[model samples]
Target: MKKIIELKQVYKDYPLAGISQTVLHDINFEVVPGEFVAIVGPSGNGKSTLLNLLTGIDHPSSGQVIVNGAALQNLSNERLSLWRGANLGIVFQFFQLLPSLNLLQNVMLPMDFLGKLSKTQRRQQAMQLLERVGLADACHRLPSQVSGGQQQRAAIARALANDPPLIVADEPTGNLDAATADDVFDLFAHLRDQGKTLVMVTHNETLAAAASRKLEIRCGRIHADTPAVAG
Candidate 1:
């Protein structure tokens, strides 16, 4: 089967006071469809940078990032935005929901941006996604009105707005309590079971151990890539 996510000789660098500092060094990996991949590493060890590369938010200094059959590095910004909207969903740690828009509108925003569905259809699909994430009744509440977990659920719903094939999350449950974090993990597992490729950067060891595959990064290199012993 074809790879859903591939990074070839990936290296990421940033300029610090005129010198280049490398964050990811010669990274290479491939993720197939229907895989739940958890990336675990120490703080500031290039985990989030890797996710940014995969999601097209940041470009690799020199490498290829192919996701959902599209070479991300080859796409123009405009095309990349469109492609990302249709092919990938990102769940953020902070639950980056628009404060003014209620949960329903937040979930509908992606569909609106893509414009593949009518307003009515977007609403219907958004409602369904909200329900899928167990937030149907709270759909009308503002992000601030709900608990942190609820907001994260809304973020998940919004991420699924376009029915993207891949989901990339960066510290998605970092802000939630233990019980709530487990709930979010369960929801992600459900998505994985339904054939969505998931790659998550997490600090939670238990969650990492529960994933189908676990990758450990250290000092800008992948130290280990092994099948997770489910806990």
Candidate 2:
């Protein structure tokens, strides 16, 4: 498998009250093509911070974050945005869809930014994704108009809009009911089977158990990295 992401001796810090506080420490990690990885830990253990580093949304205080063989720290903000837009898809627990855009428009936003496709092509592609997520009818609806589960499905479709090679979600199932969470996770599994690399931060051990690998974080450090047991 091709290595899609790598983090070497990475550390991240923030200034709090005139003091430097480290949230992540000496984190070394990697993900290969088509792997589904789960990140788990107690609250405030820095799982989200780790995810941000992988996506280039945040930079490490030291060390390197290389995705698709490019070091993220070497890019300017403008370049990083473009690279990330084309290479990574991010999903948030809160379903961070634009309030003003309808579901179809939200899914098209990434493609719109990329501008490699014509408007008609973008629309057609977005509609297909929305339909795949069982949101065909809701494509014209605003995020507030849909149920939480529906919103999350739409978020997944939007994540795929740019057709990124990697997808990362922080607490993807955190806000949904058990059945709904399962459905969302099924989407991730399906993506993994289709050769898209996925990394998700979740508290649900049940879902974590279904991933190809699991990483347990404790006190801002990786406590364990193991292959998840298959049922």
Candidate 3:
């Protein structure tokens, strides 16, 4: 498989009390196309930071982040933002839906920003994504009107709005109950089957176990990198 995302000798630090504190050090990894990878670690171990770097939301202090063979460090903020919308999808623990927009409108938001599709075409694509996420009937519902699980599913639909090749999820199921989390996990599997590369931050061992590969982060470094076998 071809590499879709790569981090080469990456390091990130933050200034604390006038001293630099390392958050991620000497990180190097590659996410191949159509792979499902779960990054696991305790809280405050730079899991979120890693995701931010991968998505081009934050820059590494040193080294390079290459996505689809292009150096992310060289892109301007506006260009990076546009590139992310076109090539990368992001899902968050809190769902991050717009409270003012209904499910259909929220899913259409990304397409609106892209400005590459007609209004009717965008609506059709959004509805199709909602159907794919099993939220067809909830299209008219507000974020507050849906259950937690349903909201997360809607968020997934929105993330797929532009049909990105890579999806970066940070603790997507953190707020859901076990059963609901399992449903979301199934959706991830479905995406994998559809040839989308997934790099997810998850605390649930069972969920992580379902991935093709697992990575453990500790003390701002990769502690373990291993392939996981299905039971």
Among the numbered candidates, top TM-score falls to 1
Per-residue lDDT tens digits for candidate 1, residues 153-220, read 99999999998988989999999999999999889878877888889999887778768999999999
Give the range of the ten consecutive residues with the poorest summed lDDT in model 2. 188-197
Tell me the tens digit of each residue's lDDT in model 2 across 117-146.
999999999999999999999999999999
Candidate 3 Cα errors over 4 Å, as ranges: none
lDDT of 3 by residue, 50-120 (tens): 99998898999999999977799899999998898899889999999999999999999999999999999
TM-score of each: 0.98, 0.97, 0.97
Error of 1 at 5 (Å): 1.0
TM-score of 3: 0.97
Of 1 and 3, which scores higher on TM-score? 1
Q: Could you tally the backbone clashes for each prediction?
A: 0, 0, 0
What is the alpha-carbon lDDT of model 2 when measured against the actual structure? 0.92
Better-scoring candidate (TM-score), 1 or 2: 1
Q: Please provide the root mean square deviation of candidate 2 (C-alpha atoms, Å).
A: 1.0
TM-score of model 1 vs. true structure: 0.98
